[model samples]
Target: MLRGVKREVCLSNLTLQHPRPYLFVTAQCDHRIFYGCWRVFWATYHVIWVLLSWVLEPWVLYSSSERVKWFIYLTNWTYLLLAVQAVTEAVNFFCVHSLREDIVADQQAVPMPWYLKLQWLLYNIVTTGSFMVTAWYWAVLYKSDTEIGAVRVSFHAVNSVYVLLNLFVTATPTRLLHFIYPVLFGVAYTLFSALYQLGGGTNIRGEPYIYRVTDWSRPWKTLLMSSLSNFLAIPFMHLLVFLLRLMVGRLWECWRGSGGSEEGETRRGRGRGVTCVDLGQRMTESSSIQAELLVSCE
Candidate 1:
């Protein structure tokens, strides 16, 4: 059970009176199937971009200097994280779905393993880094790639869109203070920059800094302003993600609510009134999905 949620919710009418039983057994199965497909599709789509990036400079993998670039390393890390998640999603679809069928409406509480919780933790970290890659790149370092079919323009630069798509699928309302995760990511990257400089390493173009926006060679005020703004942007972007989740997540709830109300009314006669709270109970199930893709069984 989650921290602030009720242990037992009374949805007697939804399960018994409703034609399509508004229950977790069927909803969780279908939710896992649909989200698994989306995760696989998103992962596979980005894998192409990862390959394109590697093909651009296969030598980078072996070169410490080239591979250490913020863009290169972060993108590689993001791809690996997403690919692993794709495999997990496949397991859920193929293996767990079959074994889980014995679960009925009454036995909705499923014990989650420690590994599953670890995966969710990794999911948050990888996703936060993924979105930052996109937001920072687009805002500070976007250039046209009209002539060359290189990795920078063709496939590797869509991290912003990829992150947004992931957020859309898994929009569980997170705690505001948890914004520290992304801030810590920024701090770690700053440490990497410090180490890179300490090691007498230079960026791909032989510049002292990884990105032009954070170059130490720039004027003092310029560098300070840019660095401060970029760091601050991390929290701002997280807030935006939170806001997006709240807006989109509510819409998802309302969608389920409206659908349930219409179906429930049709069954219980035209004069019947379906409360929003009653409809919300229909969405109660496994925390993996929450209100996001809890579709009707029928």
Candidate 2:
């Protein structure tokens, strides 16, 4: 059936292949001169800001009695993932740039690198996880803690902004099936919370729950919330990001302008989905574009 074939094709997109190296560094349109630099700058900035947050976290929780258990919370865990994502992205750009010549030399289609795959997985987790944490904290647990400090705001609020900005700008491909990563992340955290409860752990407030929604006292309620969060909320967030990416892609295409050349058509086809164009060719083209831009700027 056509439906079954289409389903298979859709699932194929989830595989960790076809991610052109240029996608990591360049924007979707890839026309702008400063786009790659701007992306690297954000990655570097995220690393610096996250490091600063780590330093300030201890001070922020100095007054709390169970401050040492900060890592037990979902918010902190998500923030830590965000930190990893930021570092991975920065390193990805470095590798891509450093090995540009090598990448361009090999005419074969190179599979997406392992580190790039890790970065992409982390991207899925933090994008949805950060937003989930922010939404849950603000909606359900806003007044539970009186700690309205910069650390709190940064973790619960600005984290979403950081990921959303990346989502809006990056050319990184998103697959419908990739929603499973963040869902698995949520499930893993949920299991950890349950185990923490079984171990007679207490929250910062000395309550036997990491989160009010995830409290084990009411097992059924916790199960419902956890299921909804992991299964429903994460998928919904992923869909929202996917839609946003599509819209951003359209805008980028519009800005890029149309061309009648075969190369232009190939470049434009990337917006539809991850195409299996020759990696070496793509990298060679990307390098040439960068060189041209540099010469123009000078």
| Top-TM-score candidate index | 2
What is the model-wide C-alpha lDDT for candidate 2?
Answer: 0.66
- Over the stretch 115-224, how does candidate 1's per-residue lDDT look in tens digits? 34444445555556667666555666666663445555423455556656655665333333345665675666666655666577677767776666655455575447
- The lDDT for every candidate, in the order shown, is 0.48, 0.66
Candidate 1: C-alpha lDDT: 0.48
User: How many angstroms is residue 55 displaced in model 2 relative to the true structure, after the best TM-score fit?
Assistant: 5.0
Q: After TM-score superposition, what is the CA distance of residue 38 in candidate 1 from its true location, in Å?
A: 1.7
Q: Model 2: how far is 160 from its true place, Å?
A: 1.7
TM-score for each candidate, following the candidate numbering: 0.63, 0.76
lDDT of 2 by residue, 162-245 (tens): 778777667776655778899999999999999999999988778888887788999998999889888998999887776666
Reference-based lDDT, residue 210, model 2: 82
Candidate 2 weakest ten by summed lDDT: 289-298
How many Å off is the CA of 227 in candidate 2?
0.5
